[model samples]
Target: MTITRGRFGHYKLLKNTKRLSPHVPDIHVYSESVLTSLLNNLQPLFIRPLLGPELIRIIKSGETYNLVVNDNEPIVTDRKSIVPCLIKQLHPKKTYIIQVNPTISYTPCRTFYTLQRKREGANWKTVHKTVQDTECTPRYMNFLIHWKLNRFLLAVAGKLGDAFVGCHTMVLEIGYAEGAFFLYDTILHERNSKWSQYQSFIRSRTIRPFMPHTDLCTKSTLKAFLRNYGKAIIKPAVGQQGKGIVKITIMPSGDFEVQKRNNLSTYKTFDALFQSIHSLHLSREDYIIQYYIALGIVDGCPFDVRVITQFDEEYGWIATGKLVKVAAPGYFITNRAQKLLAVEEVLSVPDSHIEQVCINGSIALSAQLNNLSIIGFDIGVEEGGKVWVIEANHVPSIAMFHNFGNNEMHTKITQFIGKRRRSLSENRKEEG
Candidate 1:
C-alpha cells in the first residue's frame, strides 16, 4: 500500500494516477510494430491472445513468422490482420507483458498488508510489511520468497544497492478510500450501472428483495421511505468498519425507534427522531437511507454472509471464499468485532445454490466496476432461503476470515488472485 503524499495527518485516499517508478524502464506502451521492436530489442518476447493457449514468437531466431493464438495452430497473420487481430480480441486494461518464460506457470506478483491497530488512539492504520505465501512474497515484479527476514538489511550491508530498488510492489492503499464507496453507490444508480445487469443474471425466485439505493437522508426522503417500508437503514455515504450506522424502525402509528451500537432511542415524532439523530453529530446530507434488510439471525443477533470473488475472462466470475458473520449483540453490522460461522451452519439454502448466487452477484458487480478484480460482497439470507445483497466492497478486510480460523479460505483467495492476475496480464489487447 501507498505510504506517501498523505493528507489530514492521516493516509487519506487521493485520486491519483499510478506511475511506474522513475528508476524502472518505460515498457508499458504496447502496439504491434512497437511490440515487435521491443521483442527485437529485448529478444524472445511473445504475443498472446485473450482466449486459448497460443504463443506468437520469432521463428528459428529469424524476424519472419506467423502470428497465431496457439503455438500448434498454423493460421497465418496477414499484414492487415496483425494489430486488428489483437484489438478485436484482448482486453484493453487487464493485459500486461511478462518477461518470464510464458511456457512455465508463473503467478502474478501481489502485495500483502495488515491492519495495524493503534496503541493509544481508537484508529487502525494500514501498514506495509512482508507477506508470506505458499511460494513467494511478491516485491512488485520480483519474489522475496527465498529471502531471509532481514534480507533488505543484509543486502544494504553488502552494498547491493540495486537489490531493493526494483523489487517492491506499488499498491494503492484501499482501506481508506471513501471515494470508492461513493463511486460504488453511485454506480448502483439505475441509469448507467448493472443493477439491472444483476437482475438479468439472478432473475430467479431466490432474488428476494428490492434493489438497494443510496440517497441523501433528508426529512422528506426519510419520511417517504418510512411511509413505504416502515423500516430503513441510515449510514454515512462514505464509511468503514460499520461505524455511524443507525437503523430506524417506525410503527404504523408513527412511533419511531432508532438503534445503533449499544444505544437505542424511542421518539414520539419523526422530527424528534431526526433531532435525536442530529444530536449525535450526524447530518442528513452526509448519510444515505436504504431499505433495512431483514437478515436471518444466529443465536440472538442478526448476521450476513461475506462472499469473496475473483474474476476471469473465460470463467466470468468465481467465488473463492464465503463466511457467515454474526453481528455483535446490540449492533446491526458485522464489522471487525463480530463472530462468524460456516455458511451451512446458518443459511438454509443448498450450499451449491448459495455459492452460485454469490458468483452471479460478483459477476454483475465486476461488470460495473473498473479497477477491482477481487471483491468482497455482504449478502443476507431471509427465512425462506432467499438471498439479498447488502453491499459490494473493493477493499474488503480478510480479518474476519482469519478470526474465524478459516485459513483455508485465505489460501484459496491467494491462489485465485494469483491465477486471476496472471490471466489478466496475458489478455492484453486494444479495445475493439
Candidate 2:
C-alpha cells in the first residue's frame, strides 16, 4: 500500500513553528589530545544523540568529567579512564567526530577568540592573527563527536587558551531567549489565544501611535474602525511574506477604496467592501484591523526601513544593520522582489537620526522579550519625518542588504558574532 506524505499521522507537528536563527556554531573537530585537556578543566559536557536533543550538562571531578543527559543519570569517569572505554567499548569498530556545542552555556573560557600558527616559507615559523572574519579564520578549539555515546566532546581551551596570544575579544548573544531561554516570537505565534499577550507587549513599548490595531471580529467592529480611521489595513494577526493583506481607504466622498496584491476596488458602503473581503474566507478574529499610516514614498513607491538587532553578552542590544526596501510602483508590500536602496538615498533626513530611532525602538521592544536573539522592525517615516514602526519580525530575511551590495554591514554583523563567541568563552571560565 502507498502512504501519502503530510497526510494524517505521517506528518510531523511542532509545538513551536517559529524558525530558529540560522547560526552555524563555531565547532571544531575532536581529537585525542583535545579530549584529554577538556577532562582536566572540569567543564560541564553534553552528549547529544543523533536525531535527539543533546546532553544538557557536564560535571568534572578531579580527573573525571561526568557527562549529563536529560531525564537520565550522569555518566561519571575521567580522561585516562574514560579514554579506553570510549575508544574500545563506545567506538571499537567505527569512526566518528565530535566537538563542543558553541551555543551551550558551559563552554570553557566562553569566547570565540583564539590564536593560530600557520606554516610559513621554509623557516619563517608561521603567520598569526585574531579571527575577526570567517575568511581565513582559525578554530579557537576542536573536539571529537562520540557517535556511540551520542554526545559531543567539547574542547575546553583553558583560561589563557592554546599557549599563545590572540585578540578577537568580545561576546554577544546574536539571538536567544533571555533568562526564560525561549524566543519571544515563538511564544507569541504558537497560539491564537496569545493575541492579547503579544499586543500588550507591543503596547508596553509605547507603540500605541505607531501601531493602532483593534479587533476586527464583527461587522460593527469593521464599521467603527472604518469611521474612525478613514483608511485601514486588514492583516492576519499571525502571518509572513506579505500574504492575505488588504488595505481599505474610506474616502470623504463616502466611497470605500481597497487595494490588494493584484487589483484595486471601490465600494459605496462598508458592508459592500467587507463582503468583497469575506469572499477570501479568512477566519474572523484570526485577523487584525489597523490604521494604515501613510508611508514615506520614494519615486511614488512606498518604502520602509528594516532594522536587524541582536544581543551581545557584553554590549547588550546592538542594531547590526538597517536598509531600505521600496515596493514596486503601486505595490503596497515590500519584499525582496521589489527594489531596495540605501537608507541615506531614500530618507531626506539624516541617516543617523533614522538609525537611532530604529536602534532605540528595537531595544525597547527587546528588553521585555526574554532570550531575544534577533528581531527586525519595519519602520516608516512620514513626510514630516515623524517615525512609525510598521511591524516586527522574529526571523527577517536579509535580502535587502545583499541586494544593496553592502559588505560593510555584513562584516560588522559577523564581527559581532565572533566577538560574542569570544566573550562567551571568557564568561564560562568566570562562571566555572
**TM-score against truth, every candidate:** 0.49, 0.50
lDDT for model 1, please.
0.50
Q: Candidate 2's residue-wise lDDT over 303-330, tens digit each?
A: 8888877678777777888888888867
The C-alpha stretches of model 2 lying farther than 4 A from their native spots are 1-202, 205-209, 213-217, 417-432
lDDT of 2 at 102: 32
> Model 2, residue 57: displacement in angstroms?
52
In model 1, which runs have C-alpha deviations exceeding 4 angstroms?
1-215, 251-254, 278-285, 423-432
lDDT of 2 at 328: 83
Please give the CA lDDT of all the candidate structures.
Answer: 0.50, 0.49
Residues 1-432 of candidate 1 have per-residue lDDT tens digits of 432211110111111212211111132234666765554442334443321122344321233445433223434554445566567545676343312122212332322222222121223332332221223323332234223222322222122112212111111211111111000000111211222233323333433343464334545567777878889888764566677788899966668988887687789987787666654534222455677788888888888888887776676678878988888887777774367788877877876776776676665544433545777878878766667777666677776676667499888787777887776666654322
Pick by lDDT: which candidate is best? 1
